[model samples]
Structures are given as structure tokens and as C-alpha cells.
Target: MPNSTSILSPIDVERIRKEFPILHQQVNGRDLVYFDNAATSQKPAYVIQALTDYYQGYNANIHRGIHTLAERATKAYEATRLTAQQFINAASEQEIIFTRGVTESINLVASSYGRAFLREGDEIILSGLEHHSNIVPWQMVAAEKKAILKIIPVTDEGELDLDGYKKLLTSKTKIIAVNHASNSLGTINPVKEIIQLAHQLGAVVLIDGAQAGAHLPIDVQKMDCDFYCLSSHKMYGPTGTGILYGKKELLEKMPPYQGGGEMIKEVTFEKTTYNDLPYKFEAGTPNIADVIAFKFAMDFITELGKENIAAHEHDLLLYATQQILKLPAVKLVGTATQKVSVLSFRVEGIHHFDIGQMLDARGIAVRTGHHCTQPLMDRYGIEGTVRASFSVYNTKAEIDQLIEGLERIINFMK
Candidate 1:
């Protein structure tokens, strides 16, 4: 059963702001307006405390030792798998595999699943809006396996061309990888439709949910995706820990991603056997402290309710976009009908890096440049964009400050 809870209005913005202690500070003698959430969200106090408590209390290497601390660490670490399973509404906890982040998660699939199943002449379809993490791994595997890479073209509005995507699907298309939300553009792709179409062509699909995990409702079972990737840091958890959710049957078929201590069942001079299910992909000591703290991050979202969070962030997006678009010499880069709370744009004749620096001087934090989507930037015929992404704790006041800063920058530059 799905983890059902009463939908509450996204926490009172004032109270939510207090939860994030970092938001209370001033930068450059001005209040900090953090707009770099699409890069990595600021962690709440609870998440921070969880990390501290783990290290100060039950810090130990997990799964191998028979000591009490080791047992406690193992239980706490594995509990995060359950939380992630529920967070994404996956069918089973066995599907969650911890990794460094979304990049490693995608690479795991490309190296293990791609190497095991993909062959020469097989085609892998990707969207034009993919982050480098999603694009490069497939390129490496496709090149090595002699498979072909095809892209679902993006429309002028920064959306996947579904018509073109349909035309690209063929019997030889074995895999389809795309982001649930474009980190650079904040365009939320219709992943369910994308997955369903790929399945019809007998192609396995992977959805990179790095940007969507905290802002959108993700039900992997509902989407029926073969693989799903997430970054905990992007979702208010610590860095260096995330999840890769693969369907049980597909995960069983894929080979281990790396060889290390915990992933082995039995090893000798002659032969070695691998661990089962999730552990097979999660090798080494693992990010135990952050993984434990990640559960708190998931709980943070669950308590607030995704619907409420999305509604609040959507308001910020609308308000910010309206205000920013009204400014002189500013043109929005992405105008997708559906998007997260991201506003990506370019100012006429103003270098994005300069705009970013000016914004920072005023204590505003926004991401500028290709945002790890260089190919997507090339598609738009631009070098990069100034991206302001909103999170649950952000308020309309912050957007107002951003607009004021941008207006000043635009006027001065003009």
C-alpha cells in the first residue's frame, strides 16, 4: 500500500525557513536569497543533527562486524532503503541501491545493465535536455558495446518532442534514459508517457529523478520504469549519498557495478561470488552516516506533503517568472508549460557569469552557466543560462529581492 497521509499546506513558509538555519544568515552584509536549489538544496537542522548523532553515537562500519555498534549501524543504514522506497513509492525496499549520487547511479546502470544486455546495433534513446551524468555514461557504454545513441529532440519551448521520440523507437532500441526534470531548465518531462512508450517497444527505461525527488510526486511503480536515480543532496539530504531504484527482475539480471569488500559473497584465489539484490551494486564501506541522515530528509518531505510543496514552489515560479520577464533586456530561455520552480534566462548582451557575480554581491545565490547540460545549451544556441530554482522554504519575498537585483543589474548593464 502507498504511504498515504493527509495533504497539508506546505509548511508555513516562515516556520520552514526557521528549520533551515542557514537561511537566517546574511551574506555580504545582506540577507541571503538562495536560488541554487537545483544544484543542491540546503539541508535542514534535523538532517544535520542526524549525521552528528550517528557519528557520536553508533559510528561503525556496517554489515561485517558482530559488535553491537556495527549491528546498530547496519540497521540504521538499511532503514534508509525503506524510507527511499516509500519516498518514491517503489514496490519493494530491495530495489533501492545506495550510490555516491545520481551520476554514479546512472553509471551503475550503464556499466552493469548496459554491458550485460546491450549489444552492437542496439539503440539507446535519450532526451536533448539530459544532464551530462545521464548522457556521458550511456555514451561510454554505447561506444564500447557498439550500440547507437539517439536523442529525443527538444522543442523550442524546451520540451521533449514526443512525436520525434516515437519516430526514433524501433526493435533495435534496447534502452531509453531521460531526466524526470531537467536540472538546467526545470522542465518536467512527461516521464510516465515516456516510460510507457519505451515499454511498448520492448525497451527498458531509466528516469533520472535528481531534480524531481523533493519537488514532485514520484511513483516508480506507477511509472513502471526499469531504473530510477536520485541525489540526496538535491533533495535536502547530505551530499555523497543517493539511491538507484531498479526493478527486482532487472537488477537480478545486471552484473555488479564494482568489486569490493561488502559486495562479495565468497572470494578465493579461484573464484568469487557476488552479494544479492541491492548489496551487489553497493560496494565498499558505503556512505553510512549520510545514508542514515538521508532518511530524515525523506521524512521531512513526507511530513510536508509533496502536493503542498509543489503548490508553494509553483507559486514562486509563476511570481518570479512574471517579475523577471517584465525586466528590460531579459529573455527567458525555457518557457515550458510544465516546470518546477526554475527560472532560466539570459540578459541581452550581458554575460551570465557577470550577472551571477552581481547577484552574489547582493547576497543572492543562483546557478549560472551550462549547469552540466552543455549539450542542452548547444541546442538552445547559447553558452549558458542564469538559473534561479526555488525550494519549499523559499518565499515570495526572496523572489522580489531577486527581481530587484536583476532589474538593477539590467539597468546598469544597459
Candidate 2:
């Protein structure tokens, strides 16, 4: 249960929980206690209804039609872009480009901007805490362009070593890409400071906001990052949809990521001319239904207010942490002072996979693996950890159930 006294005001979690239809189901014999929110959040009724509404009512390709359905679809699709622009406080609608998810968003920037601006021997600074999606794209870009990759070390506490990061910056540093929050560890990074420091050396900063999008407040203008990527699935929206926000000037200067129907202003065997800003990057038919549904998800968040959502999750995190700490032989990983709602831990003599399976039997879903951060796992000298992430809909009762499950697992295993 939450403490009677707290700094942050509590949200009506019970009321919010009712909005998520999936939570009402039984996974095993028991009611589902979903803790795998970091992997992907469960969709709310609003979002699911929005998806159904789009497919049943007005399903058509956007941006290239004169008919009623086409215009309706196009209008609905563009509405999401506007919400996303306002959601992140982007300077212009032209700066927001739709993509599959954060993976494609990062790949777009790496392929286009890296190839265009990065020269041989230029340096790209990454952190040890980066997800594989964040790491691999830059590595590919670096290898192809003969650019060098520099890394900021993560401390034992799962926080990035800012002192070490400062050392890596020099005239050769062309780009600095890192996450706003660590997906595996949930550490809230000092991105504003990072962007400021990187700018002093003329290095562009790209923040992977996959984990931060749902849990934290985002303002691209305030953060002053060159690029920011967010995944809709992580933000209580549909899967296979996301947005990449870049400064208009940078986006205008960089080449298009994909070449296809809508991306061309005019094309010929002799010469091809690209479309303007966002349309230049978004080619072919996008995931229109999911993208349309994503707007409702954002609307849900906006209606509840991000501050209230964060407060609710933080209370859950604190409650889970306190209860989990009471159990024996459990070692918490990523004890950062600031974090979102993720709690990762490893038992002394138990495999994380077994722990996950045992918990699943009791209807408590959790993530168990290196969490696509194999490099970060290697840093901590552990194979993997059991990760239980919270959301606005989670409650103390569900967390108590988790603690009870963990206790049972421990006593039975031992």
C-alpha cells in the first residue's frame, strides 16, 4: 500500500485500471497482473475503440485521394501528427515523421543524417546503457562511413558516467545519441545537460525516448535535441506505429530515408526530385489504422495529465521496491536516484528465466532477459535480470500480489 504521506498527489488508479479491458482477463487461473509495460503497454478501451472505428468506418490510404473516405482517412491520419507535435511540444508539424517504431526512427536518422554529414574518422558517442536498437544503427552507420564509435560508461548504480562522457567529446564528435531514460534500468538521463555539452563541440544529439515517452513529460524544444524517437506501443498506443521528431532545419537539409510513392515531388529516369520535409521521409502506405489509434492513446494520457500518470507510477515503483526489498536473497539492479516505473532484480541462486516462468504461473507477467541491452548486462557482469515495469493502471494490490509470488518462488526454490 502507498504511504499515507507523499510529495506527489495520488491518481485514481482503480478508476484508471477499469479503462484497460485486457486487465480484466485471467492469464492462468488468477487475474493478470501485468508488469511488462516497458516491453509494450496494454491498450486502453479508447485506443482499441479508435482502432475499430477506423477500420470499420473509414479505412483508406491517406494523402493521395479525392474521395470522401480518402479525405476522412487523410484528415484522421494528419490529426495524430498534430497531437504528437503538441504532445512533444515540437516546433512544427513538418518536423514530425511517421515510422514503424523507435527502431525505424533511429535507423532513419542513422542512415540519412549519418551518411550525409558524418565523415571518415568522425566520432559518434553512445552510452553503455543503450538498447540494441540504439546501438546497432549507429554501428552500421559508423562502419559504412568509417566513423568511430565512443561510449559513455555506466556506473554500478546503472547511471551513465557523465564524467566519462565529457572526456569522449572533442572536435571529431559529430553526433551524440543516447536514451532519455534507460529501458532496461529505467534511469532518467540528464539529456538537457548532455545536449548542452554536445552543442558546445558542434555535435548533434539524438535521444531515444522509447522508455521516456509514456512515463515522462517530453518537450523537444526545451530538451533542444536534434532528434527524438518515440514508440506508440510503449505509450499505450497500437504497435507498428511511432514518430520521429527532428528540427525542421536539420530535416530539410538531410536526405529522405525511404524512396517511394508519396516521397517524390517528381521522378524520372533522368532525374528525381524529393518531396518537402515530412512527406519526404514517409514513403509508401504507413500503418494507418494503428497510427490513427495512437491519437486516442495520446488523448488518454493528455486527459489524465502526464504529471498525474508519473505520480501514480512512481508510487507503485516505491511500493514495489519497499516490498521486494523485504524478501531475502534478492539483489536490486539499477538503483538510480531517479527512474521511471521499472524495477529489475536478480536472485542469488535463481535463473531469471525460471523466476519469470514461476511468476507467470501466478498470473504476474514480467520480462526476463538481457532486455535487448546485452552490452549493459555485460557491464554489470550478469546474464540478465527479472524486470517488472509499472504503468498508470497498476495498483498496490497488484504489487502485493507480485511480492507474494516472488516470496513463494524463493521459498519453493530454496
Question: All candidates' lDDT scores?
Answer: 0.93, 0.94
Q: Model 1 over residues 24-85: C-alpha lDDT tens digits?
A: 89999999999999999999998999999999999999999999999999999999999999
Best by lDDT: 2
Q: What are the per-residue Cα lDDT tens digits for candidate 2 across 205-234? A: 999999999989999999999999999999
Off by over 4 Å in 1: 1-5, 8-10
Q: What is the lDDT of candidate 1?
A: 0.93
**Could you tell me how far off, in angstroms, the CA of residue 253 lies in candidate 1 after the best superposition?**
1.0
